[model samples]
Target: MAYLYNTGYSSGENYAFLEAKGLCSYIPLHGTYKGGPDGFKYHKADDCYTCPQGKVIPFKKVFFEKKNHTKKKEYRALKPVCVDCPIRSACLGKSAQEKKFTVTFYREGYERNNARVNSPRGSYMKGKGQSTVEPVLGTLTQFLGLRKINTIGIDQANKVMHLSAIAYNLKKYLKFTAKTVKSDTKAVCYVILNIKTLITLQIRLLTSS
Candidate 1:
């Protein structure tokens, strides 16, 4: 089975693509944390979230995020309740209306990703990456002029990255090809000698007979 190892750059689209390719990915969420905020806790039974100050924010509506094309559930507190609350200043300062928060409607994918990342195997993979891939990337950036891309637009950046990867792989390919050719030559000679010895033995037996 194939696995994709990456940092936080992986998006929902990336995850979907990997799934389509039948490969599992070990990537942290784009953001440090999911859900609304530190103060808000989701209540599944009531289908609402309880704020730090014990105020309930009920579900308002479900909508799709246009950018990622993912369904989201929007929750909000009543304008009157928020307006009169003592902690309104601390919760949502200078707001004339109610407080609002949104969470993904299809959360199974995220939860599954979280579980994979928190597992023992995931931790080992992360540590291995830190010791191997991260250092190589660091070296490339520090010495190979990959620290910053002085280009604009995603297309240009992608082109530059492809060119860089080509150059890097070409160097490795040259080194690998030389060694492989040498080993192959030695193996060919060894097989040819064995064949010659077998032929000579057969000729001797025929002559003796």
Candidate 2:
């Protein structure tokens, strides 16, 4: 199965989790996600990132980020290497001794999911969802008196939603039946008018003969 979500739920952990469960995710990447620093090239074989100056910043270790509690991989370059570099100020802030950064442990999964999200199929899915699903949600929230479920408990909320769905369906059905009946009535009237004209023509012919 595939799931579609907004950028709010876009994260490396979420992508990894979905892939682990054999599900495809079509969520766009978050705004804060930069993939990696600019002017850096990642070498898969070495498992390292090469800076614009052709310096390799090897992978240091994997650790859990305290704030978000997500697994991340650390990479750092030697202090001596950054000391004399022309772009030292730009690459590393004045307080830092060396160039260091961390990326999500599930970076590979993130890349795969991001690629899928940017593909043609992803665009199609997004359009289909907006056209087919969003309007119903809008109607429910705006016109169907379902802006809020005042009922307490999940069971009650479920019942309310079901009733709302039933009402929408009934409205559609009634409109369709009404149109069908009106068309049938018009067709019958047309046939009767034609028959009356034919009979009047026959009488005129008999009288003239």
On TM-score, the candidate that comes out on top is 2
Off by over 4 Å in 2: 145-164, 181-209
Q: Which 10 residues in a row give candidate 2 its minimum summed lDDT?
A: 200-209
Please state the error at residue 157 of candidate 1 in Å: 16
* Alpha carbon lDDT of each predicted model: 0.71, 0.80
Tell me the tens digit of each residue's lDDT in model 1 across 62-164: 8989996877889988887686788788788675478888887745556667677789877887887889778767756886879899889876676666656
* Candidate 1 TM-score versus the reference: 0.56
**Tens-digit lDDT track of model 2 for 64-113:** 99997988999999888787888888888778988899888888888888
- What shift in Å separates residue 199 of candidate 2 from its native position after superposition? 52
**TM-score of candidate 2 against the unseen true structure:** 0.74
